[model samples]
Target: MSTDFTDARLLDALGTLASTAGAAIMAHYGGASSIKSDGSPVTAADHAAEQVILAGLAGLLPEVPVLAEEAAAAGRWPASTRMLVAVDPLDGTREFISQNGEFTVNIGLIADGRPVAGVVFAPALSRLWLGAGSKAEAMELPPGAPISAATRRRTIRTRPLPAGGPVALVSRSHPDAATSAYYAGRGIGEQRPVGSSLKYTLIAEGEADVSARFASITEWDIAAAHAVLAAAGGEMTQPDGAPLVYGRAERQFRTDHFIACSGAYAAAGRR
Candidate 1:
């Protein structure tokens, strides 16, 4: 078994595992959803996908502890946090319930409170993005496609802020007045309301420039794509410019509001 999370073979396997979870999610998609104890919408898809991912991870990296969204929600968490796997089997449940193509399955490897490797797969769109160390890439993998099918992938990197100005990305379902004011204050007129971790992948791929949230979010919600963005030469930091850390079991893995920006935007102190 490969203990190196950044190994290309491991990354490929992780991507395949996520795609399998995506298939599970699609099986339950469009079906009725129920409210979790936290009042968040959940469907069979969420549980189904989580099962697939957890089982796969146990075989792939048995030594690493997994902190998964559904498990954490049930007050189950790994005792150790030194090295952890953050999993959000189905991110954007709302988008998933709404039947949009923006939902994703995320798996991130966190060590020393920093995400070192991660994969984000959007089954509906047949797109997958991954990152490790200082490298990131994206490819198309249909619902049941194997990792071997990811033969045509593009290496992705963040670009400098466009001359026209940074293109901002916001949540499609969680709009707020504070975010509106933040954009307006920066004279950011070009904004796209994206769903799930797609916003981070966009910034990592140079299709977008920045994204900010004024509300606290759970770690699994962003860790995977955060790794991708970081690997692609971007950064995800608190609004105060501090690095965002993960594996906060005490805080229930909740994170403060963060601003994600391309490398150039962060370099220019625009974050």
Candidate 2:
């Protein structure tokens, strides 16, 4: 693994690549989607965006391999490496198909099972979030604005839980009983339904306090936002309280039931 994987300039380039992929995705949004053999939905936008991200990452970091959602689904997975990039060109395909405008393009760098840097771009929302080293920030891209052009850039951090209770974010399409049960007696102030990795950004930016998922999820689905949350002083861990680790062969990139929480939630959990 390269020691410079978390370099700010490199992460910025990755962010731009994510934005480019997001543009490609928006071109095909709300059209139609096809079912992959694995029973997941796919569209031209997924392929086109993955191609753009793959090419851009190859040019920027030839030494690292990319494990992208569409490519992996097609059996194009590369050999496991300690350092690689995880790309979810268009996350929340169902949301896209339903025209909810909640999908996003994600690009993440993982080193030794830990995410080091990442970018998440919601093209329809004209928003972008990035994490590099110890810094996490968000930007508001104007309508038709280039990726490099943002009307505002702001540093983001997780806030302490309120005295009343913490707010929880749940998957809009895959809400499971387990998630609700987990917070049933914990006194969660509110539960919001959100799509894609944006849930992590919500917590990282302190818009929400925590997210718990009992359903299966892949590394690509959460790695990018995981980096952003971690940079913003949050954490993601299995229900048993172990930190979620990526690049696992036995599990095949599938994560177990886990919780992504702000510092406040994490501290409370330990009590």
Candidate 3:
């Protein structure tokens, strides 16, 4: 569990851990759910997946502290904060409860207030994405599949905005007026609604072009996918074009409104 491991090695470890956590979540996909004090839905799957991920992370990088959604909701915070792992065991619990295959398990490595490496695993979709540094990759793996060097993966990168316009992605469950207005004002007519952090990955893989969110979101919700997007030649920033960063303990790991887009779109002054 040396922290000196390379980003590629770290991504592989996280990919395996995320896939395992996804299986834990799938075990109770349709089970009962309850409301947390914050009014957000929580199910056994969330806890189960968190347990698996936390344990895996402990083994993978013992020195790095972990900040996870379920644990934080339960008032559990890691002691050390120099560098940490952000974990969202089940990112789209509503989607999971609704039996849609749009939820995901996210794990991101944070350093210097930015996500440097991370993994996003959608077990139901049999899709996985991971990135560290300039290398971002996506692959297919079943819910219970094990990851190794032999795992087949393809390099993924963001595509330049089309000559016509950039396709926009919005939250499938939390559409707001401000976001709609932002896109409409940009003359972005083609929009696709997606759940969870998948919107970031879509843009990362060149499947889409941009995502603008005026609504505030949590760190664990976007950190892993943010890393993937950055590594894939995309950028996430505030509406004023400031870099989106993580590990904001003062804000309880919450983030301000942000926009994510491909490098070309960003360079084109779309934000």
**Pick by TM-score: which candidate is best?**
1
TM-scores, all candidates, are 0.97, 0.95, 0.96
**Model 1: per-residue Cα lDDT over 1-271, one tens digit each:** 6878789999999999999999999988799999989889989999999999999999999988999999988889989988999999999999999998899999999998988999999999999999999999999998767888875698999997788888999999999888788888775649999999999999999998999999999889999999999999999999889988888888888888999989998898776
Candidate 1 Cα errors over 4 Å, as ranges: none
lDDT of each: 0.91, 0.85, 0.88
Collision pairs in model 3: none
Angstrom error of the Cα, residue 145, model 1: value is 1.4
Output the TM-score of candidate 3.
0.96
- Span of 10 residues, lowest total lDDT, candidate 1: 180-189
Clash totals, every prediction: 0, 0, 0
Model 3 worst lDDT run, 10 consecutive residues: 1-10
| Steric clash pairs (candidate 2) | none
